[model samples]
Target: MVKTSMSHEDYLEAIVMLGGTTEVPVRSVDVANKLGVSKASVNKAISALKEQALVIQPHYGDITLTDEGYAYGSSVLGRHRMLFDFLTKAVGIPPEVAEEEACQMEHAISDASFEKWEAFVKGLDV
Candidate 1:
């Protein structure tokens, strides 16, 4: 997998969340709205993603994820979901706090470490 910045990962995840995996492409404006950023920011991120061949977009057109992009984005989203669940359900953190923390942790945790942690969590009775 291509190494990408955390910001780029966020953009890819946003695209997937916005249905970039489907035949229907995702609009830059929607991505901006989802990420609480400007259209210019989305444009910049899209440009970077295109450079990486992770997404396809025409001039001023909607965005669609390539297969690689979808897989990477889905992995990030999955990590976020798992971390959020652990924080909220297992640790009893507030939903809002867990959401924020999970977002940060998802980018920092190594895949190997995450896998081990997941195994540990699964082994728990509760």
Candidate 2:
């Protein structure tokens, strides 16, 4: 698998979020709106993802993730959710603040550290 930058990861996560539960087509505009980015930016990011074989979009068609893309996006989403929960519940941070911070921290956090943090947070409930 190709190593992705934080920006690429963000785009992948946005695509999954926009698609939600349904397998409906997710357009570039939808991804742009979700990420608050421009269409051009989305196009560029999507191109990179395509090169990595993580996403596929036909000419003027809707965007869709490949199997690898889905797995990667899900992992990123999981990290974001876990960080958000930890920041808000364990650290007593406000939801808005935690949300923003978690988004930034999710890209930088390592899997080992994240697992430890998640375990510690869950342990508090037991």
Candidate 3:
């Protein structure tokens, strides 16, 4: 619950993806490339994230997530992975379609709905 827009959530997730397991610092260029957005857009998003204390970016330096950012990004990424698995593996959706749909749904889904959906997806394992 970051109380931010879906686009902001997307930026957070993109940063986490670029940073990877070691949580390495990620450059704004990398975020722009990963998101397929312009550098200006990435800068704007980064500025907002900085103001929220979610990320830290030194002047003319790479970006790194704060503890809060990592936690929130982890949740966002988990939702994405879970939905991707459920859509593609359980419901037989095409991978590309599932990826797109999951991205949209992840930001909008309520916790209660996700709880039920996750339970159903888990049931598919049985």
Candidate 4:
């Protein structure tokens, strides 16, 4: 079985997708809401991320990813999109199910598998 190094990558990616704007700001509350986790949990994760230098919270109101954080999150989101699309379109699954399953699958996908899926989707994109 392949190991996923950063399970929290999903939360960070979901945060950016659900409620994020580099131009504006993202609150930990929004992350909590999006993730359906408690604010306390989000705060703790954010603190860990900061200590790891993966994110920054210069003020109390905003949470933003650092370059490394954004990079990981972007990859996670990209994999999520591809997996969700494959589940919904190719497998004829419902959107809601696909979305939930994609959240699980994205973290487990390999770079090679992700590349193939992305390419296949793009090939279908005429």
Candidate 5:
């Protein structure tokens, strides 16, 4: 897998969340709104994503994820969901705090460890 900065990963994830995987292309403005960033920030990140061949966009156009981009973004989003669930359901963390913490943890956790933890969580009766 290509190594990308966490910021790039966030952009990819945001794109996916905004339905970039669908036939309807996602607007850059939507991505900016989702991430609470400026349009220029989205533009800069989109440039980097284009260089990595993760997204396709024309001048002032909508964004669509390539297959690789979708897969990568889905993985990151999946990690965030899993961490959020564990934090809120098992650890009894507040939803607001868990959301923020899970976002940070999703980037730092190793794939192997996360897989094991996911399996463990699944094995639980709860």
Candidate 6:
């Protein structure tokens, strides 16, 4: 459990997604560009996350999530998936828009709410 939730996890997950194709290292600039944040902001967040042991960095290393960070990020990612599914299937939303909205919606979803939604989505025939 991190003291910072949602926004912090959002930035980390964004970084991981951008770093998906490359295992080299995730630069603050890369995260900034992906999330439309400034490099300085990313750097600050990274530093704070590192202090919390949610991220790791060496002398000149890229960002790597600690187990705690990864677990939290993965849960957020799963919530994004559920939102994407419901928006597209139940609401007849366009994939592009659904993905965009899901990214934002994932952060605020409650655990209980998400669970019920997941069950509802799962029970759907299509």
Tens digit per residue, CA lDDT, model 6, 15-114: 6676532233577778889889887888888888888887787754678778777766667777888899889989999999999899888877778888
Candidate 5 colliding pairs = none
Clashing pairs in 2: none
For the record, the alpha-carbon RMSD of candidate 6 to the native fold, in angstroms, is 2.7
RMSD of each: 1.3, 2.0, 1.8, 3.3, 1.2, 2.7
For candidate 5, what is the lDDT? 0.89
- lDDT (CA) per prediction: 0.91, 0.85, 0.86, 0.75, 0.89, 0.77
Provide the clash count, candidate 3: 0
Better of 3 and 4 by TM-score: 3
Q: Arrange candidates, best lDDT first.
A: 1, 5, 3, 2, 6, 4
For model 1, name the residue pairs that clash: none
Candidate 4's residue-wise lDDT over 1-126, tens digit each? Answer: 222246577666866786453444587887888888898888888877777776788756588776676777777887888888878888899999999899888877778977887898888872
Lowest lDDT block of 10, candidate 2: 16-25
Number of the top candidate by lDDT? 1
TM-scores for candidates 1 onward, in order: 0.95, 0.90, 0.91, 0.83, 0.94, 0.82
The per-candidate count of clashes, in order, stands at 0, 0, 0, 0, 0, 0
Runs with alpha carbons beyond 4 Å of true place in candidate 5: none
Stretches off by above 4 angstroms in model 3 are 20-23
Please list all clashing residue pairs in model 4, or write none if there are none. Answer: none
Instruction: Please provide the root mean square deviation of candidate 5 (C-alpha atoms, Å).
Output: 1.2
lDDT assessment of candidate 2: 0.85
Q: What lDDT does model 3 reach?
A: 0.86
| lDDT by residue for model 1 (28-109), tens | 9999999999999999999999999889999989998888899999999988988888999899999999999999999999
Which parts of model 2 are misplaced by more than 4 Å?
Answer: 20-24
Among all windows of 10 consecutive residues in model 3, the one with the lowest summed lDDT is 17-26
lDDT of model 6, residue 119: 88
**Segments of candidate 1 deviating more than 4 angstroms:** none
The TM-score of predicted model 5 comes to 0.94
